[model samples]
Target chain A: MSGAKRGGIEVLSGNDMCVEGALAAGLSFFAGYPITPSSEIAESLSSILPRRGGCFVQMEDEIASLGAAIGASLTGRKSMTATSGPGYSLMQEHIGYAAMAEVPVVIINVMRGGPSTGLPTKAGQADVMQAAWGSHGDYRTAALCPSSVKECFETTVKAFEWAERFRIPVTVLPDEIIAHMRENVDTRCIAEAKPFDRLKPGKPPEEYEPYSYEISKEGAAIADFGRGYRFHVTGLAHDATGFPTNDPEEISRCNWRIIEKVEIARSAFTWTEKFMLEDAEILVFAYGSVARTAKDAVLRLRAAGIRAGLYRPVTIWPFPASEAREVFREARKVLVPELNAGQMAGEIEKYLTRGCDVEKINRLDGEIITPVQIMEAAKALHGRKKAQSSD
Target chain B: MAGRRLSPAIDIEKYLRKRNLPHIWCAGCGNGIVLGALLRAIARSGFRQDDVAMVSGIGCSSRLPGYVDFNTLHTTHGRAIAFATGIKLGRPDMHVIVVSGDGDATAIGGNHFIHACRRNIGITAIIVNNYIYGMTGGQVSPTTPKGSRATTAPFGNAERPFDICLLAAAAGANFAARTTAFHADKLEDLIFKGLGRKGFSVIEAITPCPTCFGRRNQNPTGVDLMNLIREQSCGIEPGGKSEAPAGIRLGVFADRDEKEFTEIYAEMAAGAGR
Candidate 1:
């Protein structure tokens, strides 16, 4: 790890980075019910936030925690809630509400092994799929993954920014490893970050349609609450006016627009790191803590004269499909290693398996995929391919 | 039930959303009467429609938010008061009202209710205690009177019901009142006082669940439920000594002025340069 200071910025752990990121994003309220791995986010906020003119509430349960956070967001304050797997499951309904109601809130899901309470203290990237589709309905959601402690801070800040700009709930999907890992993070990276504010209605209150989308040069515009702009927000499909509308035509238009807003703004939402892929014959795709192992494996493979590269996705939701396709198009084979049983691998196959050989190395036993395991997988694939060519 | 009448001068219709008609409430349900009382109080208090925010958790009574023409939030089960606390803190200018049912408020949301009371946020909570979980069938609720037969407790309820008003009083609510839907006029008066109070206030309205609690408890008609309320309730005069009735107690049990949570928070913030 780097020393306590980097480029005039103080070094910190991933959990401390989350706290710094939250503060940098101008979060004024945190309502959370603590669970393992994710509890430090709430604990840090409870101590630091009140001293910084913000409020931190330990709600009775995960459901109420998200509820209070959504309530706080509606009042024009940047609000957030943090939880692990079981708690994340409890928050799914409110997450849908925040999406439908266009409430700006950030949810940090520090994942653990689960279908339900599977492993409380262990790390797992099992929630990648859940973060995208856990909430009911056809809605556009954003989930960002941070591999290192520095990225944990930076991604949390980005989550709040995107939530405010898009007027939707954003999730910082960190697994237990990154959430609990100690690393030196430069907080000054956040100091230079620009925050996005909620879009205010341009017209008078009487003429303003709360959910009405005006395609600006930037993107879809959002109307902030308490700006005298009144409209109904329901969990049901609604028209541009935000009133519940069952009309299929209106619903289709609104639904498509919801998708379009995130789709068209993909460039701004995507984050990735490409290593030694220019002349590489093999590409390893991974994310979260698995990406960290993959990076080490790639370095080892390069030292062994086996030209291999690594592609790490920082934003897992819009699933870096296009970039993964581009990277895989030139490679002879692509390897995907994840904590879950091929969730992201399935998504990668949807986009990147045109003609290249695709392979998956999965572990569901609530243990991190070690660097040696990744290197072994790569070597096994290489030996098999070399044997086939010799035959 | 027909003999009593509220003032015709009160325009209760103004607070209603006419397009969202054909309400989900059962026919002859006293929830309509309780809704009327709340509207009357809002009208009488002279609060601007824009300045009022009604929040509710999931239940038949919690559906009150969808019917009201105000800044409303129909939230998840048992979390209305927590949501209301956020709204009150976020917009101190708005008159925040939390309408919930027994199951929604006292069961799932009981902790939030007690904490909100303990914080003493300047908000009014009107708990429509129908003594049954009406939305999800006649399930035994936290406020289901002991020995009553509910779907969950088919033989008979072994658990004692929570007296919500007493809980609020114990939790440091500045104002706490208990009334039934039959007493619409008095319900409105207490609701108005709660709305005007500077600290956390609770008005527990003993409403009728005609489809659930009523049918299961052998009171099939809404009028029969109203009669039960009338017969069981006895008045407790404000600040005067009184004796309890045979069954449920009626009227405000406690009312006092105290520093609200927001005021104290603001003062503390100001002291700390917020």
Candidate 2:
């Protein structure tokens, strides 16, 4: 199902750009249930994939959609699914299965206001924690946040690459603003983007072990069922041979490898972008659509000589702990503005060992954070931090 | 399931995984009988040892896939059909078979099962109906006969059980059949037909959970329950269950010649002018 990649400049929304990125990255199969803000990804792919001779299935629900994607990925197809918050909640079980079985899949969650279907048409950055902890177990997750329409396409391609390289589910996190926001994108950049392919077995079937935990050896290769290398795959805690085992040591080894594979590779994918943090006295830690407002607010603060800077995390999970310590060390205060009720600030607070006073600017009324609102919150939080430091 | 011995004439040990021997089934569990029928059917169908991929959901019958020596996949509870759908769609050349139970197929996975049937995908679903949730110690299931006793229904089940064959037939399965553990030979032959079909086929193998279901009801022995199933079930012509007197009719009920989904999908892709 290979076709000449689409390239050159085009005005595309973040959701449409994501589909372009997936197609450019060779996404072979997509199974998703329609949800607001993210529905465009499913709709675009449904028409695009069949034309390219790839598969696109709209399943009965998010759970089955992810289930189908995982099943297809077992056959070595780069499969993906997209959804908003409520659908994202239903996808957690299969996400955990993908992690446990080391099945590579991509899930796009268009952040919306929700504890349960709160706002379908509007945006919310509340699902940052859920992206990391929605599943029920001790497992590390890889997630990329795209603040712009252009980043949406690039990060999606990166999500596919990282998912295959790490053999885990990678999420492309964008909010309703970025998902719906239209902007000019140069697709020529994707031509240079190298989509990392899943590892194939180099040894004979007799010498191969599906979950050997050796990154450089036979363990690196994934075996397809129809291929000569036939092996069993289960979600239960399994040994290197890919069979269920109750032994504590084996369970620990199995669990540790999947975590370590993502953990050690953190520097390769975990990242953040900064604007004017050189001599800043105040820092705004933001992401997703809120980062856009934070950038404008930081620029306005600079005009007034407040020395404010923006620290936007393009990758949310694997929280860039050490980077946060270095970037915000000199700043007097860290202001976290998010659409949710301080979810991102809560995660940032855990790793602020440098003792910088962290303040939160949160909104839960289903409105995207504005630059003026951010400036007001920053000034207020900055005053509180100054008072606390002096006291 | 291994406590009882059958005649030495039938040798199906070659198809079983010797390492997983002394399986986890209780004595006289009818799942063993169903497993035998499946392996014999595979052998008779001439599918190579590596050709078939066995997928299963969670239940007593789901454990059968783990004991067999094929490209087996023990998936999440109630998602076997969904998982198999992907496998078939991913690699249309491979043969995908789903071995799930009545509760797995008709209750939790009912949506996936019917949708797969509706799409006419190339999959053979062998659903073993034990009347109750055998894995969870006799909880009332969607297929649990009304008036039957269960742990969750101590006074007798108040809910009506699903007639799964009719469900599959109505949902547009290319082939649908019903049999019991007593009809082991017939079950094997029926599986052969299901495996030979081009689209979604369902073989609802009605087995007895002697330990939980039979102990609560009148029939306590595995043999007794098998005889009851055989006596109660009536035969009918293929695609003709609607006209038969309705007391759980057996034999093939639907066999249509619709286009398989994956083939149709491939054909559509080929004509897409990419």
Candidate 3:
């Protein structure tokens, strides 16, 4: 396989962009299992990471892949892992562990159609819910969705930054379409995205406590292994020193701290691309690869003299709820077209005000929700809104 | 824990997180003995405390890391070896040790355990074979001998037990050995050799779970279980044959030079970078 040469503009698939993004984000280790749609990420990183003074390992399974990445991250390395639908399902256990342990790790899930191996080579946004609630816990993690190759690279870099800043695993979701589709991306522009790393313990080893909020208000300030800090990290609910505790107050604080920390930084993590959303009566909400098609439909609808606009959320989870509320405030009609069976639509419905006519077009036959289909739904939604307004 | 002194010269308190103790392991449980052996081994290895990282999965044995004053990580159940693989690869200079239970290593985490051995990635896996899941309350584990009674196996365990050392050797670990908690000195020695080895090392420490495994079987107390283990185990002869009956054979099973994952990776990585 030919590698992407550094510098200048290059045509690269989303998976290739992930490798470039990971490298740009100062990734020092990657451990992943080979799965369709996401395998290219593991394949590319396997060679590239080691060359850059990093380590890449093809782990035995998806669980181990995330497990290894978490371990590496704990040792003061910016580590990541990539996988697909079934593989993502396999990683949920460790995902919760990473959250509970407050390990900074990046996990990229190249979305494909599936409850289990439903469609390996095709795209689907069905994992939207899974990305948010796959792991059983009261926790929150930043999840990013990139619609194009360039966005893929940029978003992957941002994923690392968020993971580091929050001391939690951040997921980057790009469907099989975005993962395999090649597009032109400027290396210089993507490189401009800044990287973030966790805060290291500022005090002496003897004086340091691993998870003391009094030490740092942002990310975890635990010391790395072999650095003489000699701290403990555990998946069980723990006290400030990172030791397991059965105390109700300590456990409640541990659970709430992980969830509320991300929630507090919700505004910083919320990101969206509003296309012609100004004064548009018909606002279409979508994300991931399908958002690209929705944007196209919005453009086509505008040409046909329909007041349509696209609101695409790059940060899929933590849902950009406030922006959705503000954007949907004045719109008379809203439409959500997705590759899944109305997953994002349900999320959209949660934020909209009463009396707004909303419609959703869902496709689950391993085919993308085409722009024509979205335009039809938007037109119908617009028609109902217009008829009601006239009455 | 109050009166018994396993090794007087080692100054074991220096290697302990005293504030986090009294450990949660049940009374008469062999996890404490295994932990004591591991500590003694670490002391003998002469590695800097800062240069050692102890990782463990969920179990009574896995809880050992919490009581140790090292760069310890208590990860999810069945994933300690996988996590240790990452630590060893990330910082090859550090000595990484994984303390796992029989169930943690061979049941839910069986795939990762075998793959870690295959990679030979310079991790010392101290699989504490208590033959039952002590943390979860006497459940039948993958290492529980056939016909053994457990909470889950009210009648008797029908599945065959895994010989952890043989499994490690066959799976391509560079060093593999089996020693019981009753043989504390031997367990310490074996763990020391495992720490010194340059590739994946597996030390299956067969310890008693007096609260769970022992009470269900005929061995009711920790001492009884230790005596049972002492009676069943015999060292390998010079010719590598054991004269003991069909019981647990305790000795080194494999030790040979092979390319370790980190060294090979580093060499290859060194050549590729600009």
Candidate 4:
């Protein structure tokens, strides 16, 4: 571990921070493909994990990399895979398999621009919607966005904990900016952080069922692999016994449980940071690398005599819908500045009605949305709201 | 012929589900023959049923994992080797085997195939080569012979096919062999040899696909496909001179003693005083 000479925080890159987080989370296996901005993750793991009696393999492609991670997870190991945009598209089907089969695996998608091989080295938040619905069919995913190098380290460990606790795939969506940026990170504090373990069934092997949901007065429980309990897992809709079934009632029951586990655990999984929102007239909703720019824009707006604040979402998938609704009910206007062509804006519009105005400030030319652009959007929205009130 | 008659140690009937039976292969298709050989080898290896992990990617042969009773994963297309690599690395105590097709292994998964062989990880890879893509109809594959007529190659294939055994040998595999399903006993022996090898071991079983490749190539019957294998293959002795064609030689072509990848990795870690 690297540290400062004076016993303070050490300067580390976002990639190194992610490595630290994975190590702290007790990740034993890392299987991945070498894509830009994400290759450092594989490289670091290859060097560090082998020394710690852990495993690292550079898989042939992204799809297999994720599949391998799932396989490693099934055998009772904390496993993860990292990739960029095009590779993330290739991993969609297996992500669904992990969701449906309830396998605990973490996927790190360092976002880049693309519909197809668009910009490999550039940063973009275009994967926001894709992270939620990239895989086919109906299912919920736990996705986190980290703005700083420190959060990059902290959020990855959080992703592992949530995935193991819930027994589903958890995605950490960091753009190329956050993935490649270097900043001072407190490694000493992280070394003392506590990690969550997978839920283990206390019953004997014969009395246990792998996919059987035991509902107490509180909620459903997930069982850890090994320790004797055996059950079947498949890509198809399955029953509580983990056996494949096509019965409509069984399918409905299985699907709802998969969705409910995350929904019921929403309070623990959802994360957001609000700055000066109590008395703000204009609010900017942002996440990932864009959130950092939004913060600077808020400061610039405040200097320009505009009451603007930022609501940064740390978890993007559940979309922070409840918090957004609450913020919209209080603020007159909300500005969503993203790297994509209005992806997160559409998500925001879904939670707002006629009273709350949602404005989209988008850029899709493989460039980061600057603080100046967001400030301009916020100023424009504020001007329009003032004119409407005067009339 | 001199070896003892060995019965399978594991219960084959219980290990495989018969309800998924009357498999999709044509009558007398050599794939079933190859599958039998693999099951027998697994039984002979003496591994516990729960400790064996079988994985496959999409294709006709990739369906083998679904039939077996164990920790089985039916993964995405052409990625079985990669998945098996993860399993072998993550759980070194478990016996990991990958069942793949020629097109699946050499086309979409070529990079993984060569690199896995180079690493010489403790994994057994069984590739069933029927010379064409049987699942998606008779399309020309990486193992399709030059000038063979496939659905996509109506004018005969212009590209050269890869000799998988030679490729594995060049990529640093500890064990490599080629056999056809016509020689059932020989196929079983090679599979057992592969399973017993400590490093990356590859068994290329020349199988039959009568429904797609055979019907399209005008060899419509399953027996005709078997006859093709029987006529094309020749035996290669251990230390004796044998007259056999370069492409159709059957038997273990490469076997050498080397430290397996996992053990060497452990040794290096120990040397570093970890």
Best by lDDT: 3
For model 3, residues A1-391, the per-residue Cα lDDT tens digits are 3245567887889998888888888898999998998999888887777767889898889999999998888889999999999999999998898888888899999999987889999888878999889999788988999999988888999998888877888999999999999888777755576777777878999988877764223655657888889889998899988998989999988888888888877888889999999978788888988888899999999999998999999998888988888988887688888888888788788788888787888888889888999999988887887788799
lDDT, candidate 1, A1-391, per-residue tens = 2212234556466777777787778888898997988888898887666666777777778887888888777777889999988999989988888877778889999988887888899888878888889888777778999999889878989998888887778999889999888866555676676766676667786686667765432644554345454445555577876656779998887777666777777777879999888877678999999999899999999999888898888998777667767777777678899988898888877776566677789988989898888888888888777987799
DockQ of 4: 0.37
DockQ of all candidates, in order?
0.42, 0.67, 0.77, 0.37
Tens digits of per-residue lDDT for model 1, B107-205: 889999998888888999999998998888899999888889999999989998898888998899999999888888889989999999999999999
Per-residue lDDT value at A285 in model 2: 90
- TM-scores for all candidates: the values are 0.90, 0.95, 0.96, 0.90
**Clash count, one per candidate:** 1, 2, 0, 0
TM-score-based ranking: 3, 2, 1, 4
**Local error of candidate 2 at residue A130 (angstroms):** 1.5
Error of 2 at B74 (Å): 1.1
lDDT of 3 at B129: 94
How far in Å is the alpha carbon of B68 misplaced in model 1?
2.7
Off-target runs (Cα >4 Å) in candidate 2 are A1-6, A215-219, A385-391, B1-14, B237-248
- List the RMSD of every prediction in angstroms: 3.5, 3.2, 2.6, 3.4
Could you tell me how far off, in angstroms, the CA of residue A18 lies in candidate 2 after the best superposition?
A: 0.9
Q: Decide which is better by DockQ, 3 or 4.
A: 3
- For the candidates in turn, chain A alone yields TM-scores of 0.94, 0.95, 0.97, 0.95
lDDT of 4 by residue, B47-162 (tens): 67777888787788887776766777666677777767777777787788889999999998888789888889888999999999988988999998888889999999999999
Off by over 4 Å in 3: A1-6, A214-220, A389-391, B1-7, B237-245
Instruction: Report the lDDT tens digits of candidate 2 across residue range A137-238.
Output: 888778989999989988899898878767889899999999999888776776776777888877787787789847531225587777776677888898
